[model samples]
Target chain A: MNMKLETIETDVLVIGAGPAGSTAAKHAAMGGAEVLLVDKKSEIGTPKRCAEGVSKNGLEKLGIKPSHRWIAAEMDRVRLVSPSGIDVWLNQENVHLPETGYNLERKVFDKHMAMDAARAGSQIMVKTLAKELTLKDDYVLVKAESMGNHIEIKSKIVIGADGPESRVGRWAGLKSTSKPKNMESGVQFEMVGVELEDTRAVEFYFGSVAPGGYAWIFPKGDDIANVGLGIINSMTSKNAYHHLLDFVRECKATQKAVSVEFNVGGIPVGGPLNEFVTDNVMLVGDAAGQVNPLTGGGIISGMQAGLIAGEVAANAINEGNCSLENLKEYETRWVEENSLSFQKYLKAKEYLLSLSNEELDSIARAFQGSDFERIGPMELLGKLVKVSPKAMVKLGKIF
Target chain B: MIISEFCMYCGECAGVCPRNLIEVGENTLKFGQKPCKNCQICIQVCPVSALEVEG
Candidate 1:
């Protein structure tokens, strides 16, 4: 298996074989373009840096079915705990929302996605770390180290599906750097033997326990869960790990939990970038900050961005015009679908970060006896204003 | 910048570096040749307190 590595040429080269890169490679290959997908890890998915929660509707929209193989648990309810220990429960019966989702086994799920791309005829490479990129007139030359062997890939288009710590975006001259206020330092522990109040429920804790963010318990099984928390460290000097340790010590859901694995990451909660495409290069997924600012979820949105970018890249290549102008269609389509909502989420998150523990408790108290089915967004905001008028001044910008 | 032994090589600091002066491999963290202007955004975003300014 030790063959001399040489220069490879393709129509599209996708870096990082996560959901975004694999999906992009599949779509681009389906469009009749030669595609190459690579990841730095020896295995596609291990040491997952996520809470592993996804909505059923999101999967359905992408034509993906929740298979038993990759689904760890089916979620039915959400429990939000306030600063003063008030519990607010939301389910489909009460909230009139779908409320059905899955906690995935990301390792299996990611490998399956890479297999899909391979079935679509895209070349797959593991242990391939992209080191640098040189932009030429017609193609970008990517210098990568594959399996301890130096190699170069020349492609008409390059899709950067790297995570938040993307190097490709910087190589392409994109403004992808995040400010301290816009980033959430996240840490999680996959623990077994946890005593969960509801095996099918996802739990969240707010206020001083997780300043400027929230602590979460995403159940993987009846007795196993990923207990985690994220924080905007600019708001608090405490790092995410210390905050999570405090949560594990005090939160009832994780009190009996015994840790098996630990993972840490940074989430770009600043919304999508202003420009994700340059001449012959495009950035998708966290590389472009294509994450929901409010909830800090990126998988679904990253896949969506990947699909759009892949299709556009293929079309541009087929037409023999891989310029920035030809690739702007991906940006336009993504903006049409997410820009407005993400902007609103960013604004709401900013406003929420300014709230105090007392304000959060008061807000949670307002929902204690409210009828979730009857309460709309405006109605809920009106109630929050009534209880905490001082904190509702910027309500207009959020909604 | 000094990366302590507490670093798990999670790459949080690499993402926020304005000068793109950090590189994260599977288990290794490397600083680029470019000079750091002490933005300290990287230090603030570390999930673990692994990075600190050099004394």
Candidate 2:
């Protein structure tokens, strides 16, 4: 009887405070809807669990202005090192498109993003954990605990941006049905003192060293970098952390680097989930598994989807119908813009994992001789067709 | 019943294991000695073909 309980109401309740959640919260509030964003952590983005690489164009796609403060390194080229260490440097010069992006210090980036949401008229709460969800007349009720007190929040709509381990989506019956193959087990180390040959080119080493995955050296600065790898295929029994350590030991370029910080996390290596929205709810970011299958990068796609989700959720609130019928627009629109590319990445992943070490070396050779550029999944198919029309034909049918 | 090199350690199998018998070890996955009831849930959840079904 002595326990205190508090209650509040808002038009939208956004969960999680990563880039996706904060972006959604900002957009929803910008649309004149009362928004509340919550994160269980005391801080928004600490204990980073990412490789921290985002494409330059991807930021533009999400409409996020490049902030110099959090942008630790600006990549100029990406080198794909083959099994034989044949480096295929991909840049605007050869790839016909810019693949360069920033290596972010996510801790600072996420805090400022959520603060922006606050400035846009949304209330933000940290260290608040949503415990349960109940659907009631015209709204959803969220039961949460914060600072040793129980709180009840009512909202017309809920957006789950709660990362890979999102409970809100599960509470809304959108349980993750992803298979292990559709997820990437990733580990990274923030290292310094590596004599990086190309400070501007992020290096990806591919071979038996990282079976079923590729190890990367994303330079954070001239002598410091984030070295990580994601694995879902191959024949290794070692965990990804040990695999990364082993990779560092073996790579001539990474040997001298000393680890200063370590991070581990899982990535949804699948396309968007089968169901992203149901009655009165939508999911964004890793919660909806909106990451590239091949690259294991979600920040770009997650932020992009957040923009659409926030707009759709806000529109539904304005339209006086927060039902699944109205909210399903988020799903349709996101899929329209992103689904094909996601599916193609999945296909490309299958093709990449199927190739042997010798084939990878050959791929390096093929890229060297090619004049074609902009090697997205579709472009990858065109390149594959030149050598293996049969494989391309099979992949074409699926994609 | 061994985890091969292909695992990225997503730990989906551990999460889905009904008996909660899976443990994450350094660089590898370990299963408990409890006799599996043949639910096949772990097999169903594994994304890659890393699980060995038999000797």
Candidate 3:
């Protein structure tokens, strides 16, 4: 490939305008820096792949109001089903927020966010792809392609908001790879004509049905719902779609239903990245492994990271110091705020994935009738240890 | 350049544009004529209306 033939300049350049990139761009621009945000898709939110679940608290932090056009439904409760189909209902009374979750129209949500960043004065470029990053003498060179033409942008600072399969971080000299076993392949479908109550609840099914992972039903509305499942990559003996199909067939509502849409994607279960920053670049959101280890939710964490990266980048730019030492502040802020939760969740995830069907059932039985307190990762791990100390002892090895 | 609300801040257009004429901000997206050659390539592939050619 010919080296980039076109050249540009910016105070800050952010890649992969997903949740993280948008957040970074928004905050960075608000901080008074000239920012450029870009994405490769023809539409901001087309080819939807996420289950579109975000915590209520997460949305508020971003100053985003839940619009009906973007919100499929409100989730106030969660039902955890064991291997034998024993249901444990966790009500709103147990959680801090009354409305705990939002079922999102990701396409709309993503697009609106990008627009918000634009409204904040950041320039956004769509349908452009970042091919690589070159470290110039004092700045970074972003090589890209647009409409079959080459382009390059020089910037003092760069943010990588790219997704799990990010090449930006790798190209920027950061270790951004994930192990196969630490990844989960997922399949989701929007089914219409299904008869279901219009309750704001999310459901989880664990057992051989989902194997290594679980299945979920997030109601979009009274008649439409997102029925999806994720299985660990190690359990790829069977296709993810086949598992989703089997779950759909088993669902009483899905019988005689027509499919309105289908989506397939992968979730990184590898926990957070070991490092999220380097000299001139920072990684945020999925690229930084900000998704929850238990539920595979990243909107909240991604937004959180974006907020921090934005502030840090803006500060660095204002100070006229854009170096690895300065950018490391973003890393510190993120780790100080979320490292504990992330580490604990990562441990719990490892333990959960290694449990047998019988073990899962036993643990569920132990937790039955218990008050559904909001349990942190360590608390959840402690419960597992209390239930089976031997298993907990073995967990130490896996972690 | 004109940016539509559909832009997602991917930064690809700014990264690859010949003139580098894009800047995405919080709550708003904007662009400046910072050496833009008006190659019109950015207008061709913006995944959303976030980018457009200016006369």
> Which CAPRI quality tier does the interface of model 3 achieve?
incorrect
Give candidate 2's total backbone clashes: 12
The TM-scores that each candidate's chain B achieves against the reference are 0.89, 0.77, 0.60
How well is each residue in A85-188 modelled by candidate 3, as lDDT tens digits? 66677876675432248888888888888998899899988878776688776689998766567789899889998776566777777776655455566678
Best first by lDDT, ranked? 1, 2, 3
lDDT of 2 by residue, A1-399 (tens): 766568989999998889999989989888888899998777788767788888778888777788987898888787888888877777645562222578888888888889888998989988787767888878999998776578999999999887765556766777655556665667888999887878887888887767777888889887989898877633567667678878888888777888998776767776788998989889998879898887778887888878888888789888999999999988898899888788877887777777788878877887764444545767777777776555675588663
* Model 1 per-residue lDDT tens digits across residues A294-353: 778888888888898989988998999999999999999999988887887777777777
Candidate 2 residue A367 Cα shift, in angstroms, is: 3.3
In terms of TM-score, the best-performing candidate is: 1
> Which one is best on lDDT?
1
lDDT of 1 at A136: 98
Stretches of candidate 3 off by over 4 Å are: A1-4, A96-100, A365-399, B1-55
Residue-level error in angstroms, candidate 2, position A147: 2.4
Ordered by DockQ, highest first, the candidates read: 1, 2, 3
TM accuracy, model 3: 0.81
What candidate 1 gets wrong by more than 4 Å, as runs, is A1-5, A93-100, A390-392, A397-399
Runs in model 2 deviating more than 4 A are A96-99, A233-235, A369-391, A394-399, B1-55
